[model samples]
Target: MGKTTGFLEYDRIEESYLPVDKRLKNYKEFVIGINDSQAKIQGARCMDCGTPFCNNGCPVNNIIPDFNDLVYRQDWRAAIEVLHSTNNFPEFTGRICPAPCEAACTLGINDDPIGIKSIEHAIIDRAWEEGWVAPKPAEHKTGRKVAVVGAGPAGLAAAQQLARAGHDVTLFEKNDRVGGLLRYGIPDFKLEKSHIDRRVEQLKAEGVTIRTSVLVAGKDGLGKDSKVTNWANETVAPDALLADFDAVLLTGGSEQSRDLPVPGRELSGVHFAMEFLPQQNKVNAGDRLKGQIRADGKHVIVIGGGDTGSDCVGTSNRHGAQSVTQFELLPMPPEHENKPLVWPYWPIKLRTSSSHEEGCTREFAIATKEFIGEKGKLTGVKTVRLEWKDGKMSEVPGSEQILKADLVLLAMGFVSPVQSVLKAFGVDTDPRGNARASTDFSGGYATNVPKLFAAGDIRRGQSLVVWAIREGRQAARAVDEFLMGYSELPR
Candidate 1:
């Protein structure tokens, strides 16, 4: 609304990236967001849509238009306030979230949408530079102790909110550091570790007790491939946590990666995306690893085409793999979406990430039939093309072929949280293996067990970081209400 004709006069200006040659040499964040002047112009492009679908599109329900107007008016301080009102970690989402808000932008119907994400990135970065980001310690103490089991987006958000609501929150992490997936799963190139470090300092300044390398449950409770990569110094039992804390919130993310059951999966050089990604993160953090999984000088094939797969592609390129190829079982999506049919909603369309643009061969409508290996090690993969008819896929006759590969990375996504953790806590789980909990406004997020609750990927399965933050904030409010019989914290 800052400029009624702004949309017509301006085209979307996206963030810039370093050239591939320079960026691939090191694992560091390379996205150069729009400057303040450019951000103001981008904000001016927000139209006065009677219904702001972008608000509903965002998982945290950010007041997009208000922030846009504020930025256009050059009120940078107020812009951050509006942003923080809904999103606890704009810096994280601004950097990593797939901006569904843009997809649901009304301006995107007939033209490019407002650069909302870039504006957010600019706003938060500016806020930090201007020293506006400070710890908000509670004025009063409620004397309630809460245990947040995971240090990912959800647990961090919940811990921050509960601490702000005058509760004594103790955040526990199995990893040596906070930030569950953000710390390890994501490559350093997309998100630098320094971002997480500053937030950890802020959390400590806010009176939240941060414990690292402490597993609430012993290692035996984890699934076979679900070993947390971080070094653990101690293990805390569930009974001790229940007895010590007034309430416990489970924010442990879905960690059980879906496995490829095809023959020869037990072969060497075959690993889960989690297994491969975390090692590189550890190495980036100055931890030298022996026998670390590397794609160097190997024909690397990454299964499952998604964010994790893209990450593998990027990392493999950085590792100087001989060749990199990605495979998607589903048919390739359309290059462009039918906007009229799917306006104001996330549409299914082909998304080519920066990793994809770097260098890799992508194969769609293909499935791995078997892992081809000799002498008990991976050598290649047998594959077959698929044909879809009547909403079902059938293997094409005589379509089987073996593709050369020396290393295979399974990025097929997670199935559920490790069942052992849920079993240890005795929390009920959904059929899909996620913690069972509701999102209703009344006493929601509470699990079947008394004083036990769940949030984020542990409750909702694998999802975007923005959604995890929303759930964490809401869960914190729920926990606060349970402890104090009422809460003023925003959901």
Candidate 2:
């Protein structure tokens, strides 16, 4: 531990945010990170519990206590090293991850948890400013080539690791820019695109070739109304990729958004969250969008209260929406968890995001019955109150109402990866429609198809970016071992 009584001596400090009025006027990041002194104080709060549940709580399994100690001692150089040892991109997680690590912090058992995420954020941002993050290209070539589909976190991490392992790696993305969901799905107010651009530069310097706007699949792979957003200008046949690469790894994320099929679903003002979110991101990236699905001056009703719904609320607020409300199907969780019972694990509790703080009316235990509109234009939403009994939900008698709305966004979670991609690769799928692959260290990440592997949401279903990075790095090790009978890469 940095201090013998650090946990008792210091309280947890949180990162600050810009005023709501100021941040709502723009589409830029607003969360202000802590300074060196604040970070040190937060690091000192680490108790260095014997079990170190924070490490396991983090999807990338970052060594929490060591970095906390390093930061506490002001050894920032070593701090970044320890931080990067496990997480390929701490900046990404530090910005958006809910920080399960904090929930599992031993200190959090009875008090506020150490601010591990903020410490990591400060460390990475400092490393970037100091030019400490440099690409380390391979010393020798393995004379083998690998194709990594989807230029998101998983694909990028795997490509970088494979390049460092001396394998020629090519990463493909259907979007015009890399960073899949990170590039398009997530709003700029959460994470700007420049972060992704910088990582792309490093990946290139490490001898990885990145190709954007290229779709890899056979004909009849994607269906009409599939809702898998694509900005591809070129399509490469699966056979062509198979013939060109020595091995293949699929990391394409789950893009099929879970949709609401209700009466008046085809109304003009009704749209998927993906359709609305990506347009704003594209506009922020300097793309000219005609007739954009905007929320300006509209009564926006966002369905399915989750992160995506929160994002829509933020984006809508930025667009000067007249009013915004969110609906959730499940009953509200407790404001605070029963820590004794859920320590060292993510708990079900109320999570009010920064967006919710800006402005939003959140209604839990409500279900949308239909999109009410006139002449094919959405005007309102018909909703009914729900009650949960014995773990089952039923409608409350005569508790139906119509909510005024000019626009409705379906923010429900994703269902599965686009089936065409899996069909093109002919990979087996688990019952949940994810790629079938075990994570057993001995033969992990490999699909039933020889020389083909899968990782990230495509293999594990919709998940956090940190988890995607872990799978990518581990899958790279698996690939290296398969190629040269050994690998020096860390898991």
Candidate 3:
């Protein structure tokens, strides 16, 4: 424990950000990370409770207490080490993760939980500034090659781990740059691309080959002329991949956007959240997006109240939208959770993101029935109020309403992995349409196809980045075990 009574001594301190007015002008990271002294005080606040539930809380099972102790002592280097021991990229999660660990903190029952996430944020930012993070190449080569598809968090994590295990790892991405969802799906205002660029540099230094603009199985599914049409590499079929590489790991994300098939769905203004978000990211990266959907001088209605929806609200506001409204199918949850009942588990509660704070009209228990449009473009949305009974939701009659909107974004979340990618590999799939792979020690993450393994969103469906990292690390160990008779990679 950092301090005997640290929990009682210090209160939770929240991170600060630039004013919304100033920050909305451009897409840049606005959170001001804490300094070393502030971090120490925050670390000291960690009771490091015996039987630390924060470890269980975190998806990567980070050694929260040890890192807290290290930070409390101002051992910045050791703190980063401890943070990195479990999580491959604390910087990513430090900025974006919801921090279930805090909800699981034992101190949270009585007082505010320790600011473990902020502590990690401070530690990583400091480590990067001090040049402590570097690439560590393997001492000897295993002479085995592994191909990882997709360049998202899961793929990157698995690739990095395999590289450290002495295997030649080649990562393939259809996009122009690596960092799948992290690079494009996320808005630059939430996470900058520089973080991903630096990580790519380190991966290169560690001897990992990243082939951007490369497709693993076939031509760009987006067709001959895509928004990212510039990405064109030699096609490498999955069968050829199996013949060339010693093993193959599929870490593609769950990208099948759940669509609303209501009337007027063919309207020009309706787009998938993925379709809308990535264009802005590309523009922020200096790519021109001519005729891209803009909310400027328009009223926008974003369906779904999750992170993606919040992102749309933020982006639309930044685009100078005249008005923005968000609709949630489920009822609004309580502001606070019943701690005693849900202490060690993530709870259902109200979560107002930074985007919500920016500017938005939020509605709960509202469901969209149809998109009203004229001349094949969206004009408004027909919606109705819903009520829950016996855990089932149903719309209430006579509660219907019309919301004028110029553009609509479907942010209802993904259904599963792209079927074309999974079908290309001919891997077995679960009932939920995810790759079927066991996480047992004996089989590791191997799929029904021999020497083929799956991880991250491809295997587990849509999930948090931290969970993706955990799966990627474990999958690498499994692959290493399958490659050799034994393995030493950490779980």
Candidate 4:
């Protein structure tokens, strides 16, 4: 608590964004971070709550009050150290995480929550500018080797931790570059790729070997026509890794996108959100793609009301689409949640992202009945209105309608990880198809197979990047203990 009365004296200051017109023309981060003074004011708003619910609210359990106090005191270097102590990559979460920590802030019960995410953004950016972020290589080699499959947040975190623990760690990625979904799934307008690049360099400096474009699979391999993105030029067998490395950790993402199997789903114009999103990201990265799915001059219909759907709307607007419409199967949530009933926890409420604000017509409680098309191409979508009562949904009589659409992007969330990869290593899986593992302190993250571990989306299903980092760190500790009979690495 830098200032006891600061919460009463300061109002929340939100981060600003570039003008929509100017930002729509390019794929770059548009958020204008708050200045140091504004960040200090925001930090000062952190109440000296006894419980510090914000810490528990954060997936990685960041020391929120400590960082807030540091930022309030203008201790930029210390602020970043505290941030990095919990989060391996604050830049990613600061940009994209929904900031549940703010929702659970003590001040939020009666007033606006402290702007923790903005303060974090300022701290990390300032640290980088001041050259405070640098490699902390291990003091001595442990003489052990570890193999981490997948180069996403979880894998990256695990590799960094294990390498810093003095173990030889090699991170394998199927894509030509690192960052599983972050590399290709998210639009650059939200998160720039340079952040991931610098971290990649840091990992190398820390003595973690990064092998991109390398697929580690079993005899079956990811099928030739798998929708999961793979750019691996070399394939390594699971057996080879088991023999070469002391332990193997699976941190791959949940790449199995849920599909709408309605009539005309086979239409050429209908595609998964993953199929359309990665292309634009690659193009933004200067990779020219022929026949890339574009929304230009077309009536675009994005099904699903989640973040992925919002991303489609933004990308479609950037592509200069004639019109962009988003559909949500569930009824719209309240504009505001009942704070008294849901305090100190994530509450359900309507969320309009920057992409939605840019331009999008959102339809809620609507379901697509069928895809209407001709000549093996999509033309329109048939829909029905829904009425919900007592947690059950029923179609409204005679509410069917046909919406004109040239491109239909299914932005529904993923169902599970690519089961093929889990099966390749003969690891047990939960009913949800995620790798089965426990998080108990005794041998946590260990799979049924000895010496094999799982974390992040591969183990817990699709989740926030912060959660991925937490799982990665804990999994690294588990692996360290398994290797050396005990570990000192923080979980």
RMSD (Å) of each candidate, 1 decimal: 1.1, 0.9, 2.0, 0.9
lDDT of 3 by residue, 34-143 (tens): 77777777788888466998999998999998988898898999989888888889989999898999988888888888888899899899999999999989998999
lDDT of 4 by residue, 186-264 (tens): 9999999999999999999999999999998877678653578678889999889999999999999989899999999
Model 2: per-residue Cα lDDT at residue 406 = 98
Most lDDT-accurate candidate: 4
Q: What is the C-alpha lDDT of each candidate?
A: 0.93, 0.91, 0.88, 0.93
* lDDT at position 293, candidate 1: 97
Q: What TM-score would every model get versus the actual structure?
A: 0.98, 0.99, 0.97, 0.99
Query: For every model in order, what is the number of clashing pairs?
Result: 0, 0, 0, 0
What is the alpha-carbon lDDT of model 1 when measured against the actual structure?
Answer: 0.93
Comparing 3 with 4 on TM-score, the higher-scoring candidate is 4
Please list the residue runs of candidate 1 whose C-alpha ends up more than 4 Å from where it truly belongs after superposition.
223-230
